[model samples]
Target chain A: MKELEDRIRQDGIVREGNVLKVDSFLNHKCDVALYDQMGAEWARLFEGKKVDKILTIESSGIGIACVAATHFHNAPVVFARKTESKNLDGEQYRTQIKSYTKGRTYEVIVAKRFLERGEHVIILDDFLAMGCALNGLLEICEEAGVVVEGIGIAIEKGFQPGGKSLRERGYQVESLAIVSGMNAETGEIDFA
Target chain B: MKELEDRIRQDGIVREGNVLKVDSFLNHKCDVALYDQMGAEWARLFEGKKVDKILTIESSGIGIACVAATHFHNAPVVFARKTESKNLDGEQYRTQIKSYTKGRTYEVIVAKRFLERGEHVIILDDFLAMGCALNGLLEICEEAGVVVEGIGIAIEKGFQPGGKSLRERGYQVESLAIVSGMNAETGEIDFA
Candidate 1:
């Protein structure tokens, strides 16, 4: 966690409207070593939890979840696709999610066969700000009747309501680095 | 490679319109153990080549490429995003790609800073059929002045012109499993 916070401070760019650009190492250009370490930390945190599967969203979370999965005894990772494709057919659990960055609402779905009833799953994602994406994933998990073991987040905006609301809802959310506040002009970030 | 072919035969679905769906283990619901094996296989195939970075596209390729990066000494993985987002700012290498599955063409972009000039890279993807996606990635690699050491593909439709054309281009392409033919009605697949 300290390593991630340090890396964020060194490379994260704070922009207007609380936008933290970590594309250099977190999302777009990934550091697999750091991702492995994050996975190890999550494994340590959720040691006793039964993680039959790892669920994530497409695009950004796919890399982190897949790499982190190596630390979890290579648990299968099921990423919810944001867009509907010809390849995705058959029964699926679908939900709508609004993207803060992309500024649009899109449907996210997972094959019904992928998430079976009574399966224990841990949801992982890169950023947790408004919690809309997590909520959508939670909806799919709920529909599948799978047990929510825990939530592992790489970075969370602490000043935002997403993390707080989830914690209040009694979900065991473990965010590696929580940005309490950030300054766009000065480029200073405060971690919780 | 034999292991991959065997798994494909067991779990891969032969759908109508020449679609071989390996979503059970490869893309949608990922088998991390199998992914680790793929990474090792690519490492064995592309051995002795300088892999400064691993380049891939978003969604499906991100997971495979990131997991495979571990086999290449934890080489950083850079995934080109398909859509424009607020997080992606500054100069970029952009290309247009037609998706056979999605049935539409979309713009893909990678931040200019990720792919440096003269850096050696290996482009990895989940599937290579018509080679539209790989060609786009290669175009970006050319514009960035990066040396493409090789291309690693999990599965290639040998019946399609993509793999053959790429091989004709004088690039070392290692496909774990090459499917020469498959029957949707009989569910029989032939490997080349």
Candidate 2:
């Protein structure tokens, strides 16, 4: 987490509207070395949970989730799709999730056959803000009757209430770096 | 490659309209173990070529790309963004990619800083048919002046012209499995 926070401080940019651009190493462009470390950290944090699978949304979450899945004994990864594709056939669990980054709500879905009942799943994502996406995953897990061991996130906006609210709800949410606040004008970031 | 072909035969389903659904272990629900083998295979195929980075489009390509990045000496992975986000502020290389599965076209963008000029990149994707996405990636690479060492794909519809065209164009393309033909009614596939 210290390494991640330092990397954020060194490379992350604070833009207008509280947007943090980590395109250099996190989201758009990725640092596999950093992701490997993060994966190891998640494996350590969620050790002994017997994670059967890793669930995450598409795009930003896929890379981190895949690397993290490698740490969990190479647990199989299943990513929820945010778009409707012709290849996505069969019965699926669908839910509406809001994306603060995209500024809209989209239908998120996962094939029903992928999530077996009584399986322990670890939900991972690149960033957590309003927790809508995380909540949507949790909702799908409940519908599938799977046990969510915990939630893992690379970065959390502490200024927002997603991490705090999830913790208050008794969810074991582990975030590598939490940005408490950011100043666009001064280009300063406060880490929690 | 044999393992991937076998796995595909075992789990891949052929649907109407020439759709080969391998969601059980390739796209929707991914088998990280299989992907690790794939990563190793790609490393073997592209041996001696220093792959500076692994470039992929988002959603389906991210997981495979990340896993593949680990095998390339932990080369940094950069995924093109499918949609505009608030955090994506900066100069970027943009291209329009047509998605057959999605039945639509989307603008793919990568930050200008990620792909350095003269750096060798291996573009990885989950599937290759018409090669629109692959071409978009090549376009971005050209715009960035990066040398595309090769293209790596998990599955290629050999019946389609994408892989054939790329190879004809003097680009080295390595695919794990090539589906020569599929019958939706009989539910059979012929691999090339």
Strongest candidate by DockQ: 1
Estimated TM-score for each candidate: 0.97, 0.95
RMSD, candidate 2, Å? 2.1
Interface RMSD of candidate 2, in Å, is: 0.9
Estimate, for each residue in B1-192, the C-alpha lDDT of model 1 and write its tens digit. Answer: 998999999999999988999999999999989988999999999999999999999878999999999999999999999974444456988899998976899989998999999999999999999999999999999999999999999999999999999999999999999999999999999999
DockQ of the candidate models in sequence: 0.93, 0.85
How would you encode candidate 2's per-residue C-alpha lDDT over B1-192 as one tens digit per residue? 899999988999999989999999998888988999999999999999978999998878888988888899999889988864444455888888987876888898888888889999999999999999999999999999999989999999999999999999888999999999999998888899
Return the TM-scores of chain A for each candidate in numbered order: 0.97, 0.95
State the displacement of the C-alpha of residue B166, model 2, in Å, after optimal TM-score superposition. Answer: 0.5
* lDDT (Cα, tens digit) per residue for candidate 1, span A27-137: 999999999999999999999999999999987999999999999899999999986544445698888899887788989889999999999999999999999999999
Residue clash pairs of candidate 1: none
Give the Cα lDDT of each candidate: 0.94, 0.90
The alpha-carbon deviation from the true structure for residue A146 of candidate 1, after best TM-score superposition, in angstroms, is 0.4
